[model samples]
Target: MNGANLTLEVLKRYGVDTVFGYPGGAIMPLYDALYDSEVKHYLCRHEQGAAFSALGYAKASGKVGVCFATSGPGVTNLITGLADATADSVPVVAITGQVASPLMGTDAFQEIDVVGLSLAVTKHSFQVTEIEELESTLHKAFEIATSGRPGAVIVDIPKDLQLAEASSKPVLVETQELPVAQTDSIEKANQLLRHASKPVLYVGGGVSLGNAVEELRFFVQSTGLPSVSTLKGLGALDPQDHGYLGMIGMHGTKASNLAVQECDLLIAVGARFDDRVTGKLDEFAPRAKVIHFDVDPAEVSKLRPADVTVLGDFKKSLPKLTTEVDFSVWRKKCIELSEETGFKYLANANNPTGNIDPTSMLNELSQLMEQTSVITTDVGQHQMWVAQHMKFAEPRNLLTSGALGTMGFGLPAAIGAQMSRPDDCVIAVSGDGSFMMNVQELGTIKRFNLPVKILLIDNTKLGMVRQWQRLFFDKRFSETDLSDNPDFLQLAQAFDIQAETISQPGEVTGALQRMVKSENAYLLHVRINEDQNVWPLVPPNTANQAMLEG
Candidate 1:
């Protein structure tokens, strides 16, 4: 057996059945091995697409996503996706083939110091120097990625190692110990819980990342804590729960923003105080005494200082910190606010040109889609609209570029997610500009014949940037226009995917039903007014309480 064979075996043992990647000259040996391996490999048009697909797979499935890339340009192309994973704390293992060992530092072709370029983007970067270290290194990469707060890890294997003789060696997997929460800290948190009349639970993506969604929901139900979510934290709490207000942040629901500002105590669970979540840091949840719970000690007080910090695994910590709370008046107030200011599909006014309101359309789509279906989005107005108006059954159901906000994310991610969860309906909701960013990924869908649904929300402009330009920069709308976009129906047909277009406001439900119920890969081209902007915007550096409404 050669090293390439050993790598596959190691991955299989780690429970990875599928991977996404692109092949290059330096990585040809591994690709050759993959031809007959039990592991399935999907070739993507760009290395960036491969990486993003891996991210989508990981985010959607709660498993460590794996992607392969070869050499300098391939590795560089992976940087953006890695940065996105790093920022979102997604667990992904990226393997890249480096130039052969003999050509080290001689300015060899495609040699750009893969480890050096990726240190900032990965939790750990490994370069296999010796043949014996390959298996162990692969094992370590998976452990590092999944331990504590999940993160992306890179393993740079030199080309020579792929051809080296391989051995089936046994490596002991070390169990990582979780941080123990201090007894006094738990007592203090309980005391805060008992005293806080208007306490709110600020849930974040960490709840899902830590696999503590069930625990979180139980605690929320038991305590009857009024709650708000960060973008990534959207589905952590039941959307229909009495005390649950929708997402909170720049484009969050008004009730969430108002409630956060008015709360007397904030129980932050597995959530960081992000700038997007806290519009104005100084005034964010100002009146609340915070009790922060997280697995990572570094993030506990990184932004807003926690009055009580519980550092430990959430699965263990949530149980000990559970307390009895009575906030009937506070819960009622939040529910009233949510009902008054929440997104209502038919309630929103249509654009003068009769274009569909993205908020209303997304809410309608949310109702149309299966309860188990997954939704992924590229960065822009549509992403904010999805976050504000759509509903997800779980955090994993909404795969998006939350932290990095990468534009060309939706398509490739949908590719990864569909490949992983073939039974579930996966949809990529994108704006015209963001959709064009990685349109070549259409080939990937064609090659696999994967039943991934695409909802191209075209506004003939970079809607988010245009909105900012209109609101902040004198409405110049420069360079954001894409009025000359290719006919999307033809594009999908060229890829052998079914396609349809919808312009009338009345066509939304029927179009959504057709796309969702399609047996093959489908693309739904939705054209709305170019001037439409995401609502409930909290202008930069302002308090969430002072959000600028549409």
Candidate 2:
């Protein structure tokens, strides 16, 4: 068998049912092999789109996503997605076609050192020079990508290698088992949980990636502790759960931030103490004794030193750490804080003509969508609004570019997610500025007939940046104006996709219902006031408790 056929066989063995990519010169042989394979291939409009789509698939399905691209520009286009996956700890396998091995340093057509460029961004990378090493190399890549501390892995295969015949049949490689937590460490963590009066469970993306949501819910419910999550950890527990206090960080809810500030013991589960979540390291959870649990040992004390570090698989650690705790007083205080500082949106009844309030609209949309619906968003005020208003019932239901904060992530991500879970209702909630970043994916949607409802919030400016300038820069808006935006409804119509424009408050609910019920791809362009901002923001260098609200 040839290397290309062997590669496909290996992917199939690893249970990769779907892949996203754009075909090009050096990768033709692989595409040929893909044509006859049972695996589904989604041809994205661009290489970047292909990479992000793969990322979205990995994020939504807890499975290692795969993407293919040719040499040079194809590989270069994948850099952002690779970096994004690395930062967010999303497991992805990127396969890039290289110039023939004989090219050496001759600078052949489409030649580039993908391994060198990707080294900084990927968990591991391979330059497959020998056809004999192809199967093992791919197996290693998958193992490394999905194993402890999940991240992106790259395999750059030369064009000649793809065409080279293999001498023997490929064999499946066994994956390494994740390390278990030390019994003493688990005991230490339990001791802290047993003694604390004010304790907060801070969960992050790791819980979802580790497939430990059920365990996490059990632990939270068993302890009766208040919980808060990072942006990527939104759906680890149901938003309506009494223990959940919404997201924790810069745009975290007041209840979450205050709880973090006042907690006597902070139990960090699968969540790294990133700068965004900890505004000022010296002041963040100042009085709390930390108990950190993670699969990666390095992150245990990388930032905030842990009083007790349980390094192992969350699936094992979470259940063992579960203990009965009486925190009635702490829970009541948290409830009071939530009631005092909880989000309060302006009523739709008071909306003036022509200007719609985004908060009210998001609240309404959240109610209309199914509990199991998947919502993907680009980075902006709309993203924050969705995080605040939407109620997620399970992990991966709310997918966004958390660590990287990539602006163009929503549309392509939604495309990938819809393809992964064909029966689920997928919605792409994007700001006008974010939507335009990779708006060309509308073509991909139309081409594939993907029923992704695009809910575009057009505020006529870079809302997040403008809000920052207004608050911190003496109201100097600078070049943030985007008032001359194109008509998004017409843009969608140009792709032969149905679209509607809504500017008034009364038009929101009906338009949303229509868009959700539409059988075809649809875009509902919502126009709103440019001045609307995401509140409960923690200013740079300030403590999370020092939040500024509208």
Candidate 3:
């Protein structure tokens, strides 16, 4: 069998049903093999979108995502997505067709040093010179991506090697399984919790990867410590759960951000303290003693110093930590904070007038979907609104590019989520500007026959930036306005997908129900007033007290 066929076989063995990429000269052989393969290929408009789509697929499916590309520009185009996945620790396998091995360093046409360029952003990368090495290397890439601290892995295969002939070897399993006792970190982490009066459990994307939600829930329930999430960690605990504080960051709810600052002990699990999450690092958690637990040792103390760092998987760490102590005191404190934080039902407050507020729309959407639906959002004020207002009933319910803050993410991500869990409701909420970034994917959704309800919040502007411009830039609108938008209903009709436009608040629920009930892809373009903005924003470089109300 040829190496290209062998590549397809290995991917099938790994249960990879879909791949996202763009074809180029060096990758023609692989594409030739893919023609006969069952693995579906998504020819993205750009390789960067391909990689991001793969990440979205992985996040939605809880499996390693696969993406293919040709060398040089194709590989370079994947750099940002690789960095994004690395930062968020998403499991993805990027297979790039390289120039022939014989002409490797000759600067052959369209050749680039992909392995070197991607090394910093990937767990490990390979350049296959021999056809016999293909299966084993591909196996290793999947293993590295799914095991321990999940991340992007690059497999660079020389074009000639894919066309070379050899008997395909039996399926290869290359990456070693994670060790059993990553629990040492949990035990040490427990000690930090035991002594502290005000302990806060800071969760991250790693918790979702490890499927440690139950254990974290048990630990939080037992300890009664108020918990806050980085954007990536939004659904780590049930959003409506009593102990859960709202999301913490620049656009996060005021309570969670304040809790991070005031807590005496910070127990960070599976989450990196990115600058946005930490705000001004020097001022972040100045009074808090930090205990960090992560599968990747590098993440510990990467941004802020930790009094104790646990280098292990959160699944093992969380369970072990849960068993070690009495959390009665912790629970009381958390309850107190939850009460103090104004963590209440979404419908508790009412805004009866004006254009459809994104926050109100999101709150209503949460009620409509309840715990059964998974919601994804593109980057914008709408993204923040969903994070702030929507109730996440389960882990992984809220998906977004928190670390990368990439726009054009919601639609493809919703497709991926729909593909993964077809029976459940899936919603992709995007701002007008963000939706336009990758609206071409409407065809992708239609072709796949995925029933994803796309909620297009048409504010006719880059709402987040416009808000900042209004507050911080002395109302210099600059390039923030997106006054012109094509009719989304007509756009959906063009793709052969059903769509409806709703302008009034009263019609919001009916529109959602109609879209959600549809058997095929549906788009609901809710025309929000252009000036409506997401509120409770923390203005840049300002004290917490200086937070601007929207």
Q: Write the per-residue lDDT of candidate 3 for residues 260-292, one digit (tens) a residue.
A: 777888888888888667767777777888988
| Per-model TM-score versus the true fold | 0.98, 0.97, 0.92
| Candidate 3 worst ten-residue window by lDDT | 342-351
lDDT of 3 at 46: 73
Q: For all the candidates, what are their Cα RMSDs to the real structure?
A: 1.5, 1.4, 2.8
lDDT per residue for candidate 1 within 218-319, as digits (tens), equals 888888889999998989899879789988889888999999999989999888999999999999988999999988888978999999999887887887
Query: Which residues of candidate 2, in runs, are more than 4 Å off?
Result: 167-174, 347-354
Whose lDDT is greatest here? 1
* CA lDDT scores, all candidates in order: 0.90, 0.89, 0.79
Provide the lDDT at 516 for model 1. 92
Instruction: Report clashes for each candidate as comma-separated counts.
Output: 0, 0, 2
**Candidate 2 per-residue lDDT over residues 1-550, each given as its tens digit:** 7888888888998899899998888888899999899988889988778888998888877788899999999999988988888989989999999988989468888888888899999999999989999999999999999988889999999989999997555557787788999999999999998889899999998899888999999878777889999988888976777668888989999999989998999999889999989999899999999999998888888989999999898898889986577897888888788878777766565666567888788888888888778899999999999988777888789889998899899999999888888888899999989999888889899889999999999988999999999999999999889999998878999999899998888788789899888888889999898888888899999999998887
